[model samples]
Structure formats: structure tokens, C-alpha cells
Target: MSKEEQAMKGLWDMFKKRMWLDSFRMKESLMAYNPSEIHCIAYIGEDMDSNVTKLAESFDMTRGAISKLTKKLINKGLIESYQRADNKKEVYFKLTSQGKKIYNIHEDIHREFKDRDQPFFNQVTEEQLDVILDFANKYNTHLDAEIMKLGIKMRSDNL
Candidate 1:
């Protein structure tokens, strides 16, 4: 591979490793709820139209798996299922007060991580930050195409 390719691959690998390490630390701090559970809570809390299919697609998991997680969350008082008048056939989820609490905690964790990385970001010039954002958008577009090739539908709005 060319030097640029090698450097890009190395950076990607290191970024993924750093994410895993952060996830591990989060898992340690939030032992009451598993990572998957916290993720579901966050999703439901953020999305007003969160449903089983949406959650499954977002997480790249089976509907059954999403159902299990939702059930667990429901039982834990973190989320509640609701049926809209126009879409009574399809059930959606919303975070309860307890779920909101969990969501806030999860957000706080993310904020802490971002704050920890703030120094690196602060040192980057505006032009450099713009370049990074452009690269990220292009990379996301590429990955979205690859995912489509595999016949998988993931959320693109967030990207």
C-alpha cells in the first residue's frame, strides 16, 4: 500500500481502538445497565419516532434482538411502548422519566469524553477542522454505499 493508505488505515484502526477503550470505561461506570441497554435508551430518548424496526436497523441487529432489549428497558421503567392513533398497528417507544435519567447520564458520559478530547480539537485550526469534517462526511458516504451493497439499511440521517 502507498504511504497515505497506510497512514489512513493506521488512523482508522487507532480510532476504533480508542472508541473501544472508552466503551469499556463506560461499561465499568454504568454497571447497572449494559451498553446495549444504554444505547437503546439513548436512541429512544433522542428519536421521537423510535420503533422496533428503526432500532434494529440503527444497531444492525435483528428485530428479535431489539425487541428483547426494548422489553428489558420497558420492565426497567426506562421506556414505554405507545401506539399512535394514526399508526395503531405499529408500536413505538418513548423514554419514561427513569429512561430520561438514564439518557442524561449517558449524555454526561459522552460530554466527559468530548471534554477530555477538547484540547486536541482546540489546537486544530478552523481550516484543519473543516478538512476533518469533510473527510468524515466523505468516509461516511463511502461506508453508506458499502452497507447498501450488502443490502443493509442503516440510519443515514445521523451521518
Candidate 2:
């Protein structure tokens, strides 16, 4: 393979492995909540004014799937749905106390994962880090353009 092709394969391999690790870590750490449910809690906690459509769009999920997850969260007392008094038409989601606890824990889990990988990151010099960041930015922009070409509304750049 050419150097460019080799780099592409390496990036793809790392991306898949990273995804697998994240999913495995989340599943192992939180037995009670599925990955989608856990991510929903985090997103709702981060964006206080999250609605079904926003969640669906952000997650690349269908509105019905988001609705089902929201219902489950509500049943578990992890989230509560509310609407502004003036705007009864649009529904929003917020974390309950239990949900907040879960969100906090999730944040900690992220920190822990970062910490776990800190040794490797610490070994990299600032110049090396800068190169990695630049490459990542360029790749992400490339992906965004590809997504635009495909007419896929979900852009990684937006996230």
C-alpha cells in the first residue's frame, strides 16, 4: 500500500478500536443503563434545554427511539420532561436528582479513562500533539464535506 493508504488504514483501525473500547468501558462501568440511555443523560445534563428532536438529531437516532429512551429514563426517575409555561407545544428534558448523579458519575468515568491514558499522552511532546490535532481537524473537515456530499444531515463538525 502507499503511505497515504497505510495512514488511512491505521486511522480507520484506531477509530474502530477506540469505539469498541468506549462502548466496552461504558457497558462495564454502568450495568444499569444502556449506552444510549447513558449518553442521553449526559447530553441532557450538558444541554439543559434539550428536546426530543435535538436529542434524536444529535444521536443520529429516530425521534421514536429518543421518545422510547426518554420514557424509560422517566420511568427510572433518571429524567423528567417539562415544557415552558408559555410554550406548551415544545417539550424539553432535564435530569432528575438520580439522573444528575448518573451524569456526574459519567463525567468521572471520562476523567478516569483520560487518566488511564494519561501516561501515553504525557509521553508525547507538544509539537507531536499539535501535529496530531492538526491532522484530526483536517480529517474531521474532510468527513464533514463527505457527509454534506451524501446529504447526511448529521455532521461530525457540528458535534
Candidate 3:
């Protein structure tokens, strides 16, 4: 095979492995929340009292799916629902104490995964990190444009 092809294959393999490791970590540690749920919770934690529609757009999920999932989260006491202060008709979701607990667990799982995978980048230098970051941003931009063409949502910034 050509050197370029070999490099591409290696990158694909690394991405696949990363995804698999993340799935495994979620499965092993997150007893109550699925990956999607945990992702939603994390987003809410990041942007407190965000409306369901915004959350749906951010995650590339349907509004109905976001609503159903948020309802389940509310029932589990992991999130609380409230009316938006600026717009009374718009309902927002926020993480409760129980939600914070689950978020902390998710953080721990992420940390453990990072620690275990440290060897993969143990020798990477700042210059290499910059190159990787630039590549990632460009790739994400291309992907975002393609997704937008398909009528999917697009972020304000590509990366």
C-alpha cells in the first residue's frame, strides 16, 4: 500500500479504537444513564436552563426525542424543568443535585479513560499537538458543511 493510504488507515483505526473505548467506559461505569443521556446531561450542565429545542439542535437529535429524554431525566430527578425567564412559553432544563452526581460520575469515567489512553500521546510535542488541532478543526469544518448540505444543523463555529 502507499504511505498515504497506510497513514489514513492508521488514523481510521485510532478513531475507531477511541470510540470503542468510550463506549466501553460508559457501559462499565454509567449504571443508570446511557451515552446519549449522559451527553444531554453534560450539555445541560454546561449551559444551565437551556430549552429543549436548542438542546435538540445541538445534539442533532429531534425535538421529540429530546423532550422524551428530558422527561425521563426529570423523572429520575437528574434534571429539573422550568420556564424560561425571558420567555414564559419556553421551558428549560437544568441539572438537579442528583443530576450533578451523575455528571460527576461521567467526569470520573472520562478522566479514567484519558489516564488509560495517555500512552497514545505520551511523546507528542506542542508542535505536533498544534498540527493535530489544526487538522481537526479543518476536518470538522468540512464535516459541518457536508452535514448542513444534508439539512442537518450547523454550529455557529465549525470547531
Candidate 4:
């Protein structure tokens, strides 16, 4: 393979490894809650209109999956569901007192993580940061397109 291909392969491998390690570390930090649950709590805490449909769209998951997660959260006493006065049929989720505690913990962990990286970010020039941001966005967009194509291919093959 060309040097460019070798470099890209190395970067991809390291990126995957880093992501796996990060998930493991986060799992440890989250203790009782899984990453998805933590994410759901955070999202519910941040969004006023958090519902099964919104969660499903935000997380790119099925409504059934979000419902299951919501049920689990409700059982854990981390979240509660209520309907607005104007919409009896429409249910929305909000973090309970316990859920707020977990959300605050998650936020603190994230804030500390960012603070730990502050020195590195401080060292980077604006131009360098812009280039990095641009590259990251392009790479993410490409991956999203590729993932959609792969999903379509898989569905077609199954059919």
C-alpha cells in the first residue's frame, strides 16, 4: 500500500482503540448506569421536550429501544414521565432528583476531562484548531454516509 494508505490505516486503528478504551473508562466512571442510560439521562436533563421519539431520533435508535431504556430509567428512579396539560396523549421525560445527581456527576466528569486537556488546546493555534475541526467534520460526514450505505446494503441482503 502507499504511505498515505498506511498512515490512514494506522490512524483508524488507533482511533478505534482509543474509543474502546474511552468507553471502558466511562463505564467504570458511570458505575451502575451503562453509557446509553447515562446519555439518556443527560439528554433528558438538557432537553425540555425529551420523549421516546426524540430520544430515538437523537440517539439513532428505534423507538422500541428508547422505550425500553426509558422504562429502565423509570424503574431506577432516575427519570419520570408526565404529559403536558395541553397534551394528555403525549408523554415526556424529565430527570428525577436522583437522575439530576447522576447528570451532575456525568457533567463534572466531562468538565474535568476537558480541563485536563486544556493545556493541549491552549497550545494549539487558531489556524491549527480550525484545520483539525475541519478534518474531523469531513471525516465524520464521510463515515455517516458510509454507514448509511452499509445499512442499506445489509437490509437489501437480508431481504
Could you give me the TM-score of model 4 versus the true structure?
0.82
Q: In model 4, where do residues sit more than 4 Å from their true spots?
A: 1-3, 6-10, 13-25, 147-159
Q: Which ten-residue region of model 1 has the weakest summed lDDT?
A: 150-159
Which scores higher on TM-score, 2 or 4? 4
Each model's TM-score, in the order given?
A: 0.76, 0.81, 0.80, 0.82
1-159 per-residue lDDT for model 1 (tens digits): 999799799988989988897888688777799878998998998899999999988887888889999999999988999999999899999999988987998898888888988998899999988987898899889987998898956643333
Per-residue error for 81 in candidate 4, Å, reads 0.5
Worst 10 residues of 2 by lDDT: 150-159
**How high is the CA lDDT of each candidate model?**
0.88, 0.90, 0.84, 0.86
Q: After superposition, which runs of candidate 2 have C-alpha atoms over 4 Å from their true positions? A: 154-159
lDDT of 1 at 27: 82
Q: What's the number of clashes in each of the models?
A: 0, 0, 0, 0
Across residues 42-158, which tens digit of lDDT does each residue of candidate 4 receive?
999999999998998888777888999999999999999999999899899999999999999889877876886689789999998898789789988997798788776322113
Better of 1 and 3 by TM-score: 3
Estimate the Cα RMSD of every predicted model relative to the unseen true structure: 3.9, 3.2, 3.8, 3.8
Off by over 4 Å in 3: 84-86, 119-122, 143-159
lDDT per residue (tens digit) for residues 20-93 in model 2:
88778777868889877899999999997999999989988788888998999999999999999988999999
Ranking by TM-score: 4, 2, 3, 1
Model 3 score (lDDT): 0.84
Residues 47-86 of candidate 3: C-alpha lDDT, one tens digit per residue: 9658888898888777888999899999989999988667
